[model samples]
Target chain A: MDVAIKEFILAMVVLDAGKVQGGGCPVFHAENSQEQQKTSLYLARILDGVVHDLENGVLLICRH
Target chain B: MEKYLIAVIAGTVSGFVDRWLMLRSDYRYYPTYPHAYLTHLALGFIAAGLGAVAIPALAKPDYVAVTFLVLAAQQFRDIRNMERETLSNLEKTKLIPRGTDYIEGIARVFEARNYLVILTALLNSAVVYSLGWQYVFLSAPLCFLLSLRLMAGSHIGDIAKIEAGQLHFDGSILKVNDVVIKNVGLPAEREKILREGMGVIIKPIDDNARLTLDAPGQRMAIIHDAVSILGSKVDVGEPHFAPLARKQIDQGYLALFMLANEPDLEYLMEIIKRVPVLESTRGTTLSSLYGRKAAD
Candidate 1:
């Protein structure tokens, strides 16, 4: 059977560098909210994932 | 032998016609290809032939010919497997898939349809043989009507009430009424969704209908059907715009959210209502004594 990662966070885009810590997935820190949304959209498109907001300053790209 | 010939012809013709009637290529887009139609028609003809010959083989006391009917039944089972495999293979490429429950229901219907053809043939031939060839006029139409009636299955509209739901966002979380659909991180995407999105609430009429809607597979079917007809804005990598059906949990109703190319609420609601209630996911809770007692 073919296997692949799903329902897992592929990458993270954060507005505050201090808000996120080191994890298995790569985290990209944006200079501002505009930069943050752009980075999330780019990451989501590249990773073939979806951008989901955590309702904080963090945005996650997850494959589902 | 001459007497049996007319019976066989009458049975085979009626059965083949019954198969042809059932092989409709509707809005579902299944069996749309000529080759697919040809394959099913050929199988239906074979099934009909087998049913037609059964009575004559017994009358002739040809025990060996009677055993072939069992082989025909085995052949029909393989048709179900063939249908299941083909649909499952095709499922991978679909943006929104008809879930396993729906696929199984469809495959089972294909198998059952052949059996119905056989029954129609058997009835026709039996009538023709017992009462003379003149009875074919009466028996053939009766069998056709019977097969049609038997083929009719319940649609979503029969069990549930569908209406337009309020599509809005609470912060970044998209919702249909109070049911949470999904979270969108991109503000632009949220705006597009708010502008183009449509929502519908499926309210089950009873506990049985609620349980049917509760199934993930059944919900997937509803989404798939609606998207297929109304068209969706979802693409390969963009999962945010994917049509989704989520349960309200407490109330046992379903909230469907979708960004459709057409974006017509009335058409979307109509499509959802017409979705075939998957047989595998069909609930019979109300039929059980305990379930009826619990509801009271």
Candidate 2:
């Protein structure tokens, strides 16, 4: 049987480094909104997850 | 011997024809392959033969042969298990899987159809044996009509009203009417969704209908059926574009959102209306005393 993680945050992309603190999932800091969006999109595709905006300058990639 | 031969032939032929009529390869594309058709038809023939022999076996007072009918029933039960396994395995590869409830419903239908086939054959044979071979024409059609009536369950249209819902992004959140469908982070993806997405609101006619639509499995079935017909923009990595059905907790209505390949809102609503209300998800809350009292 194939098994995979689901409904869990796989990674995070944030515009401001101070917005998100350290957590179990990897957090990527970007210079601006464009970079943050690009990083989140790439992370989402790579992790087979969806990008959800916390709307606090932080975007998280989660599998569901 | 001649009388029994006539009875069996009449019964088997009618029953096999009934099975063929019921096996439809529609937009769902199930049982599409010729091999699948062969499997079902072959099993149907066996069911028909068993049913056909039953009356004659009884006429001869051959209690031993009649016992084999019990074995045939056991074999039919295996068909349900076989169908469930095949469908569940297929579910893994589907972009929008037919939920377990839908799979169970389909599997149960397959098993039940065999039983219906047996009844048709038995009835036809009984008519031929008692009445006359000439009465085969009348009995066959009558049995077919009865089976057809029993086969049809219910459609979504019967329980709800489907209308086009407004699709818009509330900031990064996708909303179908007032229902929040999903949260998308990408600006480009959100734009694509706005351009291609379709939304429909399903208003349940009554409390029972509301409870039926409340089932997650039933919602999954609606999405699966709609996507199968309309085609979805969702791919392996693009989970955001996947079709979703969410209920409005306050009013008990459902809102569906999909970024479809065919973005025609009218056809999407039509497809949703035509979706079969799954047997397992049907709710009968109003039938109970407490539920009826609470509805007031």
Clash pairs detected, candidate 2: none
- Native contacts kept (model 2): 0.69
Per model, kept true contacts as a fraction are 0.86, 0.69
TM-score for each of the candidates:
0.97, 0.97
Q: Give the TM-score of candidate 1.
A: 0.97
lDDT of 2 by residue, B1-296 (tens): 59999999999999999998888778887876798889999999999988988998999989999998887768999989999999999998998999999999999999999999999999999999989899999999999988989999898999999999999988988999899998998899989888888889999999899999999999999999988998998898778788889989899999999888888899988888888899999999999999999887
Question: What TM-score does each model's chain B reach against the true chain B?
Answer: 0.98, 0.98
User: Candidate 2: misplaced stretches above 4 Å?
Assistant: A1-4
Q: Which ten residues in a row have the lowest lDDT in candidate 2 chain B?
A: B24-33
Error of 1 at B30 (Å): 0.7
